[model samples]
Target: MAEITLVEAVNQALAREMSDNKNVLVLGEDVGIDGGVFRATAGLLDKFGDERVLDTPLSETLIGGVSIGMAAQGLIPVAEIQFMGFACSTIDQILNHAARIRNRTRGRLTCPMVLRAPFGGGIRAPEHHSESTEALFAHIPGLRVVIPSSPERAYGLLLASIRNPDPVVFLEPKRIYRLVKQEVPDNGEALPLDVCFIIRPGNDVTIVTWGAMTHDSLVAADKLAEQGISAEVIDVATLKPLDIETISVSVEKTGRCVIVHEAPLSGGWGAEISARLAEHNLFNLLAPIKRVTGYDTVMPLFRLEDQYMPSTDRIVGAVNEVLKFE
Candidate 1:
């Protein structure tokens, strides 16, 4: 095992998958010779050659459509959209076609494709490069929305996404792409999808989050620990088809919950988790569920990015508020 950044782990997974399975191919703008805008696909072209590592035109719609066609025809296509903000053009193909193919064909065909995009704010990126609208895709049926928080999860989950028999939206938190390093094995093994990973265990409160927010939640958990607050931190790696059982069980133990995310508060996935808790574990709550999320507004420019995203302070504050009830 070698220590690597989240983005490097992603590149390793892609390389391993493409090497292990001839059916897996990478296609996207600047993915080949240029090795991708962020170099997540770096060195792939040299290892896999031009045939497997294709550089498509600068049209996300075309990329989405071609990927759908390839997946329906038995190829496992891993298409990359430079940024989540630019993926709007590919929504038609993803929602209407790629996602609905299997159900529409009544099992005659399956769309085994992974749409990769770097999402979230930070890195001083301009507009159209720092969006975190994952909930939009999570709302769509027949799609698995997966986000990785750490290098190990990035490596394992990405491999699982590519091998999934259905279409998946693999969102990478660019904010933490190189923020931290962790040891990840290059064993070609895939982690289970639609599951949550508990980062820290405690009995005081459950803090649920994913992507870049997970880092802040962990930090807040540690800080709260110093103040005698035992916070249980959970990384909801798979946003869609959420592993509600894990979350509900944790909340049931703590009897308090705080949901966090970088996406705006309105209609974010945090609300979905809250709803699940309210429905299934209403009696388990010792306090009202609190949400520490970004404001319900457009992600601001880099200058105010910190104010817009949920921070360690915000998470700890939310936990304090919930703890107050008891």
Candidate 2:
């Protein structure tokens, strides 16, 4: 029960799963020799050996294809793409094959693979490294998109994803890789998927967010609390099969909602949550739903990077605006 960062928790989960399940394997660029771009797979090579941990050439598309093949053949391959920007090439294999394998084979084959990538901005990385295009994967019917906000959830949710019998996109928030630490037990237990975790309970407003944005959202909630505003915060662990029920119940009680995300605002996952709330919890709302998100533009360089991402001030502003309606 040592305190660990989010990235360390991820490594613990992978090691535990690979040790318990011989079929679990890890493959990706620099995953074996170098451990990984961010070293999320650090020290796994010695522990699991080359057969279980492979370092593939720098080709995301190849990694995706190979992982799918291994999965169909009964191996649980946890493939990693160094960065989310590089993962774009894997869309062909992921969308057309991995996602549809089980349905296409009519249950004869199930693609049990976990595609891992470090996503989101805040590290001031160059172009492409800061992409937060989770909505793209979430739109794919057969895929499950999961993003963890803290070390505990990262450890638990990743275990669940690896054990799942379907293809899962496990997007790690690189921004918060070492932002904070939590006492995470290496118990091999997993958190349930397709559900939301209400990290903070309140009654005035519901602040919905995931990934790195969860950090800022929680900060905003604290700021609101000082002002006598009790803001509930929901960490949407699984985005695709969204646990709207948890969100709806929170909104129903709070009667106000503010969705947050690092992705550009036009069609980010926040929009999907907003739509679901409006459709089902319209009458319960006291104020119009608001979204505090990134602008509809490319993630800028270091100078403008902080400005582009949603901030605690912005979240509080949105909550205040919604509160004004009441």
C-alpha RMSD for every candidate: 0.7, 0.7
> Can you tell me which runs of candidate 1 are displaced by over 4 Å?
none
In model 2, the runs with Cα more than 4 Å from the true position are none
Which lDDT value does model 2 have at 127?
88
lDDT of 2 by residue, 24-86 (tens): 999999999788889899999999999899989878899999999999999999999999999
What's the TM for model 2?
A: 0.99
Local distance difference test scores for all models: 0.95, 0.95
TM-score of model 1 (CA atoms): 0.99
